[model samples]
Target chain A: MIKYRQELSFKEALTVILYTLLFNTVIAIVLTYFLKPFWENFVFSQCIGILICLCMLMIFRFITTENPLLWLLTILSGLLVGSAGGFILGAFLTEKNPLVYIRQYHEFIRIMSLGLIFGTIITYFFLSRVRISQAEDRIQEEKIKRLTSEKKTVESHLKFLQAQIEPHFLFNTLSNILGLLDTDLTKAKLMLTDFTHYLRLSLAKTRESTTTLSQEIDMIKAYIEIFKARMGERLKYKFEIQDHIGELPFPPMIIQPLVENAIKHGIEPKVEGGEIIISAKKDQDFLRICITDTGLGFIEQNNNGIGLTNIRERLNSLYDDKANFEVMENVPCGTTVKIEVPIVTD
Target chain B: MSQIKAIIADDEKELRTYLKAQLADVWNDLIICGEAKNGPEALNLVDTYQPDIAFLDIRMPGFSGMEVAEKVADRCRIVFVTAHDQYAIKAFENEAVDYILKPVTRDRLKITVTRLKEQIEVSSVPPSDLPAIIERLMAELKANQKTDYLQWIRVSSRDGIRLIPTDEISYFKASDKYTLVVTGDGESLIKKPIKELYRELNPDVFWQIHRGTLVNVNFIDKVSRSLSGRLVLKLKSPPETLTVSRTYKHLFKQM
Candidate 1:
């Protein structure tokens, strides 16, 4: 919907009445001067003409906004009613009966045709003006809708970037590396390398819309490596994927958030910390990726968290109804998140 | 001076070891009695050892450091160790609670050690204000995190769709596919299941007393033992008694 004002307000009606009276009076004055008709008769006939048209408009409530054909029909009917009424009223004032003029068929046809031509011209002018305004209104609404959606996309992108480069994660990872430097030098170096990789991938991937499954998995591996180093034996992870599926095109930063969520909300909160399993498979025309964690059982509220909601929104915009994001309780304990997107074979 | 006993609690082993090493360097006289890997373990260590100081990581498994501190505040001094929690840090600063940020440096540890030593020497009793401060901080933290709970529930009434505030609800009972939202006035059926409603409602306000029932704590008048030796709850507004299941009987243990 393109909605227009369906009812004319009191102020608008009054304005229309005033404009009609002024226009009719001007015509009446011109006719009285040049056409040699009685001034009072001409003015009275003109007044009757406008009054009948207004009455017809009020009775029918016939201003159409959507259908042009219906609008034309309404104008034609209004002109027919107004001119007929005006001619009858004018004839009664001047002569005894209007049927006397109807007996002269050519004269009656000439007067009625003239009235019809003037009415059609006036109605067409107003209709075109209304149509132009309606078109302008529609364009304005569309521009606003596009601008707002564009702003939303930009805002969500910024939020996604902020979530990816979370200060808490960065600082905690750095703290772990610092602690590791003293006890295990080699492990510390490995963690630093992984941290660098994670950061580089996060920064680079966020700027782009898409990346290969292998590239995203590489980032996820780096991310999990940092967490593994931080949590030690408390954290375990496994990845199950075939070599060919890695080459598939996937949305960047999609899988990593789910992995991060599994670690943060599911695994990190559990005392035993538990394992996270990341797997991907092709189910006919769709590519399904699943992240399962063996930690605390699914909490109903975790699904509404910023990370998961963002993933859902991104998937919705990217694929509309073609992609799906699902969260379910893992068997025995923990939470499993699955994302499915249609595969383009080429 | 008597040897000051202290316990360190952090989920990560390396951080715990690193803090121990740093503590050994900064305050040699302080005795490290125990180390804990999680919140419950930390609380257990606190109870077991009755340590003078507790170095707790703000984020730990089972319970957060803040929750642990709330329980043992009167028993021990808490020094929260966190990575980067802006809200917790702000609360700590406002309350004058001691906290050490992560990548625990010897220099920061030294400052904390000096303050802790002064506090220890000044009073043998744990600070009376510590518990209150921790309680306030926990409340603030909870308020910040719990913005998504359902405030209003949409239900179809006799006339039309009505938005009933969740606060007015006395309880919810599952009935087939729909859940009944009972209030003082009457009950309305909603399409949402009891399981889904439980998730949306604030856990603090709505207690799941049975598999099919979730009762608002505000409306609960009393808990009494039925003749069958099962726990039952009496509501103030609806004037109804609800039976508590064996699985959820522990919820009324405190009462």
Candidate 2:
């Protein structure tokens, strides 16, 4: 019996079942005759044969059909054809006791009634199994939908976090340019062009998700340049990315926030300037990005704002907590933002 | 030729004062026709003063120095003044009449006035001719600059040219005859002639800081001027001090 929709075969399954039943019936009759040569000459034999064939056909139809009305019609046809064949065969094959073979009419009628009842019950079982299978499919679909939605939300946040960086940088650079006008025009003019170049870059990358890590690092470098241009020599940054991890895929704008956090809270707040260190490497099958600043170490009060919260939420949404992102002190110096995720590939 | 009387156009009151003082200090003969705090004021000043020289700031709250320059057209020869040196440098590179960097360095402004004197002395050309000259200068600079502020170079080894954005490059090294572009993680060796690249690069960004070498100024970690007056540039990648060749040594002091 085909329980699930996937197992459902229309006309083809029906023909295979009927052929198997017909072969089985022929074998039964041949064995009965060869063993007792009586069924070939018997008047009741034809009636018995017709009854057996009808029962098998109804069961086959019931197992295959899902439509309840079609099942009932098929089962009823089985009974009618079985009885009509029995009566007609009895009349043609009987010699002396034709009425006697036909008189076993009650047995033939009983077979038809039983066939209808058994066929309906069998079909009911298959339908229930079919329903169970469908429920399982629905559950699997929901799981997939949930996972996809989670990925989308996380990605959107990652992109948001990344996008947030450029604007903040733009505004800050603009402020620097503005500040320069009152004191130093030449430097401001240079920074303005640098800032413009940075902005044009951010605009160009509006479509992609995972830019090459090298490209991203360059952008960060550009951003740092703007600060350097403004601060003169007040800020310094270093890259310690492992050589092997250079070609790895990473979320866009992933490292930018940590850099900004270092700048906004770490370096900018202090006098005499500070240094920012960025490093990336593969540790235990994961790509780990670490951003450390010489600014004052992590203070709970300053970082509780929506930025970290948003980053955390985005991380959760993307990797389902598979990625590890944390903010901790770099011991004697300052804050370090470490982001660890599976090494993704393009 | 008539005297090139000029108005000082700046949004900041102090810079305006500085321009007036500096202009007067440098060229004692330059007539200070007037000064305006905004573009409209500058325009009105240009109209009333009919000054031959107008010192304008590139960025004003409402209108830019260029916009004001367009308006003054033939009335006065204009010089843009802004604190940002690169833009001003680019303007001059573009063949702009002249521009002064902000803080209005006394010596630079003095040079500006001398240029103004020449423009005023030779100022018989029509204003219609001025815009065209400016446009031609801009085109010439654009075509002449080899690096169009390239963010990436998409060059292909397989296809003969792969375009890699300038921003994608982490650092560049001069490899004998060709420049080796250490791209993010995936590096590529580009066949750029070092000397030609130096001539074509934006000095403020891609500096041909070293002989046979060009470095993205964005990637420079520390730059120091040596005792011999050569500039040494340190980058994050090479972890070494790259000395600015004597030929290109003059550039480091500007930043």
Candidate 3:
């Protein structure tokens, strides 16, 4: 069934006409099959069926999207119009006067009732099938959308796992530690202790989803220590945190990956290996953390790696629109990533 | 008392220290004369020290432990130390060569030490099954290291079945039924469709510039606007320019 709009398109109007003809033809065939012997004007009765179907269609077209009473009135008016159409055809076929036709008004009433019943039933059944098919198509589309999103989630999770284990960083740090063992024993010892702590924290169950801000900071500190050992004198970094912000809840591995990105993309590419400044500040209901590196800022085109993208995706999933992550240029030089997360107290 | 010399080679110092401490507790005569952090260094140590036994971590920087084991198999008896579990160690189960899992406890070290002592007492050379065990382990590691990235493409050309590196390809164009794999060497034809090939290539390198065109970003010389305001990609080689449709023009926006 076609729903009413401001105006029906050519295709929609054609569909309406086609359905009307089909339903009316079926009703006429059924009527003729039963009353063919008694009715002499069988062909005339078929023409009357087509005329009455046209009346029903016109009534529907004019009052489909109007008030409920108007629609009820339209149905009642359609029956009257259909009966009148049948009477005129009967009068015309039998070559009788209007007064003579009035005697057989009961026959006209029966034909009108049959037309109304069959027309409503066929229209309702056809509309129900169309609506059901439309509903099933919508359901299938929703299922496909859900499966595609699920696949993307699983793929991102796998990428997150891979990012957690930086084999290049690991091997380089191990080699740096070996190099340090020959010259500086104390520094090597310090690096090894931090490396083991970092490994332990990374493997801990807390890192699977959530961790306290202080725990994430501790992991970042350990990471910085390992990086400092590897880069040595070429890289420098500092951290500033507001008082009492340590115990706030934060996602694990989020801040650490950003800091890693800063070093890998920002500092390591530069010859001098610039300094990084990480700061955390509290503002009303939001906690803002900024990681700024003094390296080749926006000049590096290949800066969007899995780590930064994963951070953004995880943030979106966790906080929806409440959290924000932005990458902007630092004043003097380099890039600054500012993350603002809602402070949740427990 | 006879002194048994041994070499400990692991990328991590902590593991090496723990293994040495466990060995000292298990066998007093087994002295670790040298330590190497990587495979090449381990090979150098085996040559210089000529140790009776060598403990090699399977995953090491540079050459890796399996490669080192091959070079030192003639002179030293080998024990592979790996982070992989017993399932991965199934290749070593039936062979004469032994393997110990990581986070090695004192008991596991003692077992390996006792086996080494027994072997040394029996013969100077390695057991006959050592070569076969190493070969199997190498094959297993190689199989595990195979990644999902599209590394090479097999093309049936007039030159008779050439395997071309995907990295050498500058771009791909779909023509009729076959896709043309254009490389610096020459253009090759592959039966695989462009859509299927696109999924296998690294997204960072190969970008879909058009509906039927995929170009490697490294080969891109410049992106310029045409008189008709359409974006055209000027490639470095073959002197061919590809038109970017309005739908895919965002790919060149950052350039």
Candidate 4:
């Protein structure tokens, strides 16, 4: 069974009727002057032709679904049926037997041939017009889809750039190093060493698709050390990881941004800075990494921050449904973010 | 001439010490009277030492540097110290206000000191229009910050989390380590500190009546004075009376 491309509406049917009437009136005027038949008889015959053709088209539409073959059959049958009905009805209205035109074979053939030619031209015009519109609609839909996908790519790229280097963190750490140089020489050396390690790891890892879990944890340790010096005595941290889990391959920069969020939104804002705990362990077929902070409890402002959203997008693209991210309020105070991804051993 | 006294206020101890060392190298006669690690300490240092100059970092705990400046603009000549704040730097430049960038070098400190000394010598009489300029800068900064005050506060109840709209809250009272969010329904405890909540709340709607209490102005029913002439507030909901501290009693002067 063939399917119909589109259903006809009442407005389209009305437009077709109006066009047919206009075309018939033009043909009737020319025929009246050339054939020398009465103008009234010509108009009367054309009206009968229009009525018969509309009735036949309506019956065909009700019985069969619309398709190219159906349309062709309707148009060809309408031409033959309408011309025969018009000739018989016109002869009977002029007080003659309806069979008089059928008896003149030459006149009957000429009138039927004219009807076929005119019907084919009109049908081709309407069909081509509908096809062009359908093609334009398809193109428009494809354009919108392409634009939306392009926009998504650009937005994610911009987010990646923002996640790479935070200007405030860079400048503040530099200022801390500058200050430490004059007061504590050995401490300054330690900070410089850790800062170098952090910059090298972050810059290098961002270029690669994945890294061992140990490397990401090393970068987080370096980050916490820099903050430890800057926030001296106020900031504390602990890392707990199961043995043999550090060597597993994981997506790079996933856990680091969450740590940054905890510091930026939770710890740094509080009067008494708090501790951050990073723990990783394997559970069944997945690796669970949790970062917990003891600072101000979860606030709505953190929800809109780019850090959390960026991490969510990265996880979705990399692991799809195999990864899970969750945020929960700690029991006493602060927030804990958990990430669980499938552990692939290869 | 008497020795010029100065105070340095920054959250980081290293920045404070570094700035002090740079000042000592440039201006020998200047005395470093005090150092503050946060905003409240900075204000306290200014009040006690009566410093001639104050170097206030823009971002600090308890209150921001701009907030501290708003309180002590008249007590000392203000020189803002910041790491990198684009909007604030632009505002400072436009107003011709004195400011210094962090990781202080000797050259920048020398310039700031020279400028401050001349200003102090020229205006030893009274406070100038610096306060007005500071106010404008603060307003601009707040506008740029797009500070949308807390509309809904999430609190834990007996069963689960409860989100209460700010309009429904009557007041917030500080307890031991948590704050009590009192409403018409009852009170729920939150882990957020009163001081931090004060900074997040809209100042016009929630007035800090005491160090430990913040009363929503819309919920205030009556204002009366005690026998000792201390101000007291009567709230409509929960129908409780709150005492106003000496520092914040001026907020109810009109009533």
TM score of chain A per candidate: 0.69, 0.51, 0.67, 0.58
Evaluate model 3: give its lDDT: 0.72
Worst 10 residues of 3 chain B by lDDT: B157-166
Interface RMSD of 3: 15.5
Off by over 4 Å in 3: A1-25, A30-215, A222-250, A253-313, A319-346, B1-4, B83-87, B94-96, B145-255
Which regions of candidate 4 fall more than 4 Å away from where they truly are?
Answer: A1-164, A298-303, A344-346, B125-127, B149-255
Cα lDDT of model 3 by residue, B1-255, tens digit: 367899998765656776786787788878899998777789989999989899998766556678888777878889988765343477677554688876566688788888888888898677766766677777776676534567656666442344444656789999999999997546878888889989988888899988888998888876776535678787866667888878898887777
Number of the top DockQ candidate:
1
> How well is each residue in B45-68 modelled by candidate 4, as lDDT tens digits?
999999888889988877889999
DockQ per candidate, 2 decimals = 0.20, 0.01, 0.02, 0.13
Q: Where in model 2 is the C-alpha error above 4 Å? A: A1-169, A178-186, A316-321, B1-255
lDDT, model 4:
0.77
TM-score for each predicted model, relative to the true structure: 0.70, 0.34, 0.48, 0.62
Q: What ordering of candidates by TM-score runs from best to worst? A: 1, 4, 3, 2
- Compute the interface RMSD for candidate 4: 16.7
Rank by DockQ, highest first.
1, 4, 3, 2
Specify the highest-TM-score model's number.
1
The whole-model lDDT of each prediction reads 0.80, 0.61, 0.72, 0.77
